[model samples]
Target: MDKIIRIGTRSSKLALWQANTVAEQLGHFGHKTEIVKIDSIGDIVLDKPLYELGITGVFTKNLDIALLNGEIDIAVHSFKDVPTKLPEGIVQAAVLKRGDFNDVLVIKEDENFFTKDAAIIATGSLRRKAQWLYRYPHHTITGLRGNVITRLQKLEDNDWDGAIFAAAGLKRLKLLPEKEKHIKLDWMIPAPAQGAVMIAALEKDEDILEACKEINHEETATCVGIERDFLRVLEGGCTAPIGALAMIFDEEIKFKGTLFSPDGKNKMEFYKEVPVNNATDLGEYGANYILERGGKKLMREVHDIEKSTLVYSTKSLSHDQTNNLSSKIGVTSSDFITIRNNRLKRVIVKKPIKNALFTSQNAVEALLNNFSRVELDFENIYCVGRRTKRLIEKKIGKVTHIENNSEKLADYLVKNLDTKEVTFFCGDKRMDDLPTTLLNNYFIVNEVECYQTQLTPRLIEDKYKGILFYSPSGVESYLKENTANEIVAFCIGETTAKKAKDHFKNVVVSKLSTVESVIKSVNDYFQE
Candidate 1:
């Protein structure tokens, strides 16, 4: 084919490097190429983590659309980002020569942090986070997103001890330091197709397909195929932390795979080998082995964890603000009603408040504002959410049993707590079910209000395509000034969604109940 092939690619530095490299390879075979730079939704939205976006091909979807629409002849992408199931009419044309598959820890020039319990590691990938946490349970993992260069910059600018990055990406961009500033994390199993570049084109475009086939690396393609098959068979979508690596050596195929819990406390791993002739069945067999060895249960737990973490905020958030908040939380968003806290003049604890329970940061903030260490006495502090824990830590310098919700914290207390009595510092609008549930379980509960939530309904004269609600009161507040008959309502969780369904015709509930999840719900609905 003498016609010039158009290669669609992301405009990121790493993406451009991959595209240009592919174009140069194609040029070697006497095929003329044109590089077409395009921006993907994943690139445009930097506020949320990739998995929380709740889309499979967040990075490749734009290129897939371009290929289908004839805007480009072929699309170049990092194979790991491409969904196993390609969009209709598009298929993988070529798998380029594989590169370094190991993840690398890029640390600051002066920092010597490694495997330290007190060190913080920043990485946007769930696979990296789960594995790292599983190995170093004491180390903290925070979210870091952006292109390779931006991520590197973030590592330098932020106070984090280190950040995780792909070895292939750094090598491709020539960003790897000459010194020993980066350490290869060989302990981690690479995500499927991690170090390979995939070229995709219309399945029916025989000319382009034939041209691409000439440049395809058969060995890399075979190994990645096996790895992807394992991924598909396990059904480990973006929501779960999964890793797979396949290699060919001495005319035989070797595979290693792993599935991890969200918190990284539990995991299942598999290692297998087979003759070259039996490579086609290796992935399925390995997946079956893992599934039999508790992978099935791990997958279910991951799904449950993804759905159970709810972010129920009382503040009204716009879409952009919601996205920004989700980025900060390193997850999704779910906002609800408005909150108003009382100014505590003093926290007068006449007697000892044995075990103190806090439901929200508002209560902790109120307490800290009113009382110094001398004014309060408590044996231990337990809180519901991250915000509450941070606030309590700021004042009391310690917190325990930090759960995502009141129910989970209550369950934890009932199962292991030795304390006979507890004092709950909460808001005026706090629900009574948590205390009642504890009371029925034989634990003495004393409740004190430190803050209040006021429902302030604004006149939404302009109709919106969707309304986001984080709490039951938020739903009520939203409905006080508007109708939900024609609009879609995105709720944070089952409870909030249940309340939203009472008035809205079309309701979508975020499984994770985070602001990012709510925004993802909105995008998912509109994109559908």
Candidate 2:
């Protein structure tokens, strides 16, 4: 502890501040420290974005090399810049106390600053650049590479009106010049590990690792652990504009994650809070929840953007017009009227049915509307998907069975129940997989067509250069009526793409079966 420990850090002002702070903390423990300033690859590159540089240890690689060579006892870094995968024999020995992990906008003090259009903003991160451009497409973002002071100096010397920086960095260095304002979380999400400092040491250097632990903050470590774990599970890095932040208060932890399209036009945000006792499981649960809802699709699309892919996909169904399919399949003439009138009935029904099966929310809506006055006795309500489950619970009360796919739902009902008299409230042209799967196990399966799906001619003409098809029926409708010149066709899955390929020779099928996979495929195609 008496020997002077060499602390390696970047030569930047911000890195100096971080190193000095750590030195001060270590000094209290009677540990002598010497600072070693080094230049990182990130500091030298000014032409391309960080992600384009292939963001693996651009900042820490040199410091890590110095540490392994015994030139420095510890290497300090902005935890967010550190990669999840580290070089062998090197480890993040301790994470210093976290700071304000939020993105802040620093606009120059000018009379017309708030009203300016197409304001020039400076930023070095692709994640921030993509999100900002998506939100304010009119605003121009120019790359400003340097330490905090240097960037600010560049901002003043150039035509840039503002710049974005991590609030934690400014707060750590006390660099806010009173003219700058901090942006809120609603506007911009901070990068992962944004506000934390990491102490990296040789794996074999137990003395330095143990000494560094005295300064590690437990709450910061736990919260960052959860956030980093979420990032790791998502397989996201600074390159992908994914944002996640965790807040821990007492025994409760709240996590919020956002996935934005590379261009930032389409976005999905997820929020969930769990008790601290379940913190270890929080990352997986949050990830699974996002994937179930739509995060998986968004991620694939983001990756496609990086790979320069164009995506054209849709969720509409395709039908065969020549086969008199409309008549053979049950078609309701007054379907809209039925749905509208039933929605206004404000009636609740209790039917004494042994089993209740649902295909869509419309079924639950119809049952609640028409049979509201009737009392039906059912032990449980089974739904085909999460959306149907939520709808049933909202209208009819809690549902016991929830399945991800329709086929899975059918398999579940067939395996669990012994009764044959099951009532399936569904549409006129609903898929038969669910009923067919359950028919063998039930005495009598009753399917009541509650509504109908009719094609509308309300199509927008040739507005898009590409079309995305999710169902075969959608492809049929587009091919039957609309004629466009050579538009790229993208499908969500193989089943949809097969129908698309029959009509269009230029059909692209997504490798993954989900919506995100389709989007990614489209992006990759377009970019290519």
Q: For each candidate, what TM-score against the reference?
A: 0.55, 0.53
Per-residue lDDT tens digits for candidate 2, residues 231-305, read 765667766667778888768988877667666666767678888766885664555455445565666344322
lDDT tens digits by residue: candidate 1, 1-528: 799999999988889999999999999999999999977433243334434532246788678766766888999999998887776667899999999999998877545565344888899988899999998888899999988888989988988988999999999889997557888899999999999999999889999999999999999999999898888777786767889999999988889988998778898888888887768867766776676445767773433233212332335343244444322132222223555666664434766677899876667877766677767887788887665677777678688678766677888888878876888888776653678878989999887787777777655534345677766778887677766667677776665777778888888987564566766776666655
Cα shift from native, residue 247, model 2 (Å): 1.3
Model 2, position 478: C-alpha lDDT score? 64
lDDT of 1 at 457: 69
Best by TM-score: 1
Give Cα-based local distance difference scores for all models.
Answer: 0.77, 0.67
* Poorly placed runs, candidate 2 (over 4 Å): 40-55, 111-117, 179-186, 291-528
**Clashes (N, CA, C under 3 Å) per candidate:** 14, 34
